[model samples]
Target chain A: MLSEPLIERLTETPLFAVGLTLAAYLLGMALFRRLKQPPWLPGILMAALLLAGFLAISGIHYTAYQDGAAWLSVLLGPATVALGMPLYQQLPRIRELWRPLAICLPISASLAAFYAVGIAKLMGASDHVMASLAAKSVTAPIAIGITEQLGGSVALLMGALLITGVAAIAFVSLVARVMKIRDERLIGFALGLNGHALGTVRAFEIGPTAGAFASLGMSLTGIFTALLLPLAWRLLGG
Target chain B: MAALSGFLWLISFWLIGEVVVYFTVLPVSSGVIGMLLLCITLALRGGVPESVACAAQPLIALLAMLIMPGVVGVFFIAGELVGQWTAILVGLVLGTLLSVVTTLWLMQRLMRGHHAE
Candidate 1:
């Protein structure tokens, strides 16, 4: 129903990138529904892949896409703040579990960064690579900011984040089988701590209790990492 | 309308976090600080506002989608990923293994020791 010039002008604005992203997401969701929504196969990742392919084929630049896409990315802040709701809802369990969680949280959260950065360093990567790797275990919204402050490439961190999240599906189940740890709380906590948002989604699929715990785990771990990683980076001179 | 107010509350906390960071120069995400402040506030309130509950449900549910645009940025810098693929794979695999395993094991040991649920 639009004229050719109008269409071209709209394509040059933020609408083009936003519409493309939405379309890709919808398609990814459709495909994900078809596949029964496996933990390893998240719709976001699928949409990202499709969007990338579309950009490449159409000869569109990432910069062009980013100009508009930043608007959507900004919503991540509000979403992060929204996490407070679930954490609030889980108040009863948190009070009950606070003692043990107090002991367990700091250690697990630290190792989440330690392992990623430690291994990436062992692999002979650059300092920026290590910095990017450091925050991969955290959720995207917080992780992006951490990575930026560490002078790492956001794009590279996304790749590492995806790998880490997808690996979490197998990791939790593997823990269950090999470690004989089947308590949904521990399982979901492990999943969210190690996997971030993707793991939280998988946790929700497991049950309401697991979902709440996963939310708790993800939020606390995010806060923990955000509070400390920069200090650690300063101390270690990363 | 309730959902809209909930969103407003979230942004207010987020802005407070940003202001705190601006003054303190904390090298962390304002969103995270915002989340922390929101938690503290909710703890004081003794419950989540219904508006917040409603707004948070859908936002958290669609978090993956909200995060998509940023992840898609990877395509722009795919070049940087060229030589580092091995590091990424090994890092994710072993790192996640160690992380998940140690968390479960330690939490188990602690919880079992105290008989805490």
Candidate 2:
């Protein structure tokens, strides 16, 4: 039902792929806001599904989509750096809470990695699968590098990372409520420590202070886990 | 122009971070290093620059969208995912929950200690 020129333009041009991503995300944002921002329907997940569905229906490869979307991906680095603004705004509190935060972040990050690999091993997963799962809680950029160093499949690591992020966003509120967690800082730190970037999104929704702490947790987790995972792997003789 | 300037500054910080990581033995990513550098700068300056805040606001606003491309990469390996679905799912859920609970408990314990002091 499509014209030859239109199909050609879509497949051959970069604009179509880039536009597709933005359009999908915009629609996801609209729906998310309209629906009162449910945790399960986080904008990124919905947008990814929409984009993935579009690619599936059109028979286009993800690599083709990446051709146009790569520009947006490049910004992830700067956006990450930009997180310093809010964190700087809340630096005093972060300083005051540094003792607890510094102590808790590395422990939780290692625990997340250890528990993930442990469960994977119990479930009879191969070493590569275990390695991929070990870095599930860190942000994608750092995670990909860690996975490479640990000799895991990059595709599997990417999938597991998103899965952990979505799960963290969806279940965090319930977990906090059940645990009787009321302090926003603690809640944010927990989310960021476990969830990474997606968790930071949820923390922002809770409050600015929470968002700041979440950013702190995310950064610290990335730093600690990246340094420690390889050392831990060597210690385990992997 | 302020937003543009802020954007450039953030990118420069990122570049600095990349250079630092390239030279150093630290395992942290350049983006995070940039964030730390900027945080220290802001703290020393007594506040964040208006320009940086302006640029950072919109980027943070759509932070989810920025990461979507990587997430969409998931579609490419659907076969592997289906095969490993059970183990991956169980591991993710357990790992995330355990991390959350332990961090919360330890944080509270530490905070209580500080209060007692």
How many clashes show up per model?
0, 0
What are the chain B TM-scores of all models? 0.89, 0.88
Per-residue CA lDDT of candidate 1, range B34-53, in tens? 88788889999888889988
**lDDT per residue (tens digit) for residues A1-238 in model 1:** 4455654576677878888988999999999999998777788888899999887777676787788887777888888888777777777887888988998999999998999788888898789788888988898888888888899888888878888888987888887888887799989888888899888888989997787788788888888898899889989999
TM-score of each: 0.94, 0.89
* Each candidate's DockQ: 0.77, 0.62
Runs with alpha carbons beyond 4 Å of true place in candidate 1:
A1-8
lDDT of each: 0.85, 0.80
lDDT of 2 by residue, B2-72 (tens): 99999999999999988998898565568778877888899889987789998988987766777777778
Docking class of 1: medium
Q: Which ten residues in a row are the worst by lDDT in model 1 chain B?
A: B73-82
